[model samples]
Target: MKRIVPLLFLLVAAASLPAEKTAWAFRTGINLTPGLVYNRVWDPGYNGSALTVMSLRQNGGFILGGGIEAGYNYTGFNLHFPLRAGLTVAGGDSLTLSANLDLMPGLILGIPASYFLFALEASMEAVWQVSPCLGISLSAGPRYTVSPGYGEAVSPLEFIDLTVGLAAVMGN
Candidate 1:
């Protein structure tokens, strides 16, 4: 499953390349994501402060790409390598709005041991271009994860996350 995601992303990105001229830019983002986490069987907790480093791509005309994010959450940590695909829903000269979907197959290193966590998140971001190559973005999203509970039952974990991020973008 881990190996399949990257291969699938590459295939999609390659095949979806526009026949006409299109540009692709690499982005490195530093973000602070604060979220509210709720467990099905347990009580709700707000232990969701994370410092994330994400590397994503922005296609010039069509918004589609892949990304990997490594972050340190409150008591646990996660490495989310997802196919971060986005669509430019709205935009202006200084600001651009996008909606994104992330299909993440990642490692959830909870309290004791590491386990598999398949996560899905849908988000909307508004990017304010500080300069030609720099931007500040504000994003809010909801994430759902199918996680292993170790000794407890298997269920989905939910979170509503808000992020403030800065990005450095280059290329077409």
Candidate 2:
């Protein structure tokens, strides 16, 4: 009777414990970024040039956390360090969706020159959990950057970036 009573108590205790929720995850991936440059600009008007810059990118992020990206620029290299915040918009056993914003400060290095870059980005992400520790993610975002132009003054550039990622999730 004592053994049965103790077993029952253990079962009750286990049942009373709250299930853990996923509050954190880490993602890493490769991204392709193609940016369009403006040749002339007026207030609320822009004459976009056909010039485009393509970059090969490597990125990492922490959920509700921070982000870092390194890119091989067409001429040299660039680094973006961003502060990020996000929330899960929806979720179930196998999938989740999120929206995130990032404030980034970075450096662009070119041959014999360098420039400071600042940007704001808004992104939407969808993740499919394949296992407890592995997930695949697709993210798309628009980024606006303020940086020095090639020959003129500081200018703003716009980009649409797409990323395919893999993540490790915990506390789910």
Candidate 3:
């Protein structure tokens, strides 16, 4: 199941790419993500906090891309690799707007052995392309986490996150 999820996301992104013009670009950004955390079975003691991430992406006409992200919060740190896909939903030259979808798989560190977690996130982003080489974006989404419980059962946690970021873009 762990391998299947990422493979499925990659296949979907790749299958959609050939119909587009194939303009390629790369982006690096810093984001501030604030979220509300919840658990279905028990209390986690804390509800939420702000997280900071550094992300890098390589895209093709904003249609599809892959990225790596690393971040930290009050609880610990995490690393993610995600695949993105979407379209230019609105706007014009020198300033365009795009809507995007991302699927991320990640790991969390700094917790006890039984607390080792795996996270899968899905997000929607609104990007304002300021120029051919710059953009600003805001995104919101949900993240689901699964981990081993004290006695080896599965523990599940969920989060709703909102993020704002500024990026430097390169390529066509």
Candidate 4:
């Protein structure tokens, strides 16, 4: 009788413990993101006519395309760091093809919604992510022209970007 009682207690204790809701799952998905970039042009007045000084301005555009991301989730907190590289085709008179690279780290709080996962994303980018994949990304951040004369004359421009997009997961 004593042995049976001990076994029953163990079983009850195990059953009472809460199960883990989040696991280390592999994610590969695509996102269609539309965002803005603020850019500042610095011309040291070294290169003659090619060099021009400009003030900071707000540029608006859209980045339409896809990307692949991998991340992990534990409990209600998720750690996602995704590297997105794509193409950006500018709008209006500044019609130019630009290549962008963005390294994003995001965290989502609260219980994950069914069929839909939402989170607040904050990231720093060296280049626009959609410029390589999609056609265009607005001017919300500093952009260095890939051309030879442009990048060499002015270097290391600082830019802050605000991006909004949707991500879809594929496979397990």
Identify the leading candidate in terms of lDDT.
1
Clash pairs for candidate 2: none
Give lDDT tens digits, candidate 1, residues 1-172.
5565676567346434665555555666665655554544444444444444344455553466565667665436776666667888887878888998878766776655566666787888777777776667777677766555532443345444554455655443
Top of the candidates by TM-score: 1
lDDT of 3 by residue, 1-172 (tens): 3664575456445533554455655666665555544445433333333333323332444566666566764446665555666666565665555666666655555434424445555555555666666666565555555444422543344544455555655554
Over 1-172, each residue of candidate 2 has an lDDT whose tens digit, in order, gives 3343454344334323333442434556655444444323422322121111111111222244454566654424666655566667877889878887777666665555566666677878787888886677776676665565533443344333333233333333
Which should have the higher lDDT, number 2 or number 4? 2
What's each prediction's clash count? Answer: 0, 0, 0, 19
Could you tell me which residue pairs clash in candidate 3?
none
Task: After superposing candidate 1 on the true structure, give the runs of residues whose Cα lies further than 4 Å from its correct spot.
Answer: 1-19, 31-33, 41-45, 51-61, 110-113, 149-172
TM-score for all models, in order of appearance: 0.69, 0.60, 0.61, 0.22
Worst 10 residues of 4 by lDDT: 48-57
- So what's the TM-score on candidate 3? 0.61
Which candidate order results from sorting by TM-score in descending order?
A: 1, 3, 2, 4
Identify the runs in model 3 with alpha carbons over 4 angstroms from their true place.
1-20, 40-62, 110-131, 138-156
Best of the two (1, 3) by lDDT: 1
- Expressed as tens digits, the lDDT of each residue in 60-168 for candidate 4 is 2322121223222222232233333334344333244434444333233233221112222332222223333322223222221122222244333222223322222
The global Cα lDDT (0 to 1) of model 2 is 0.51
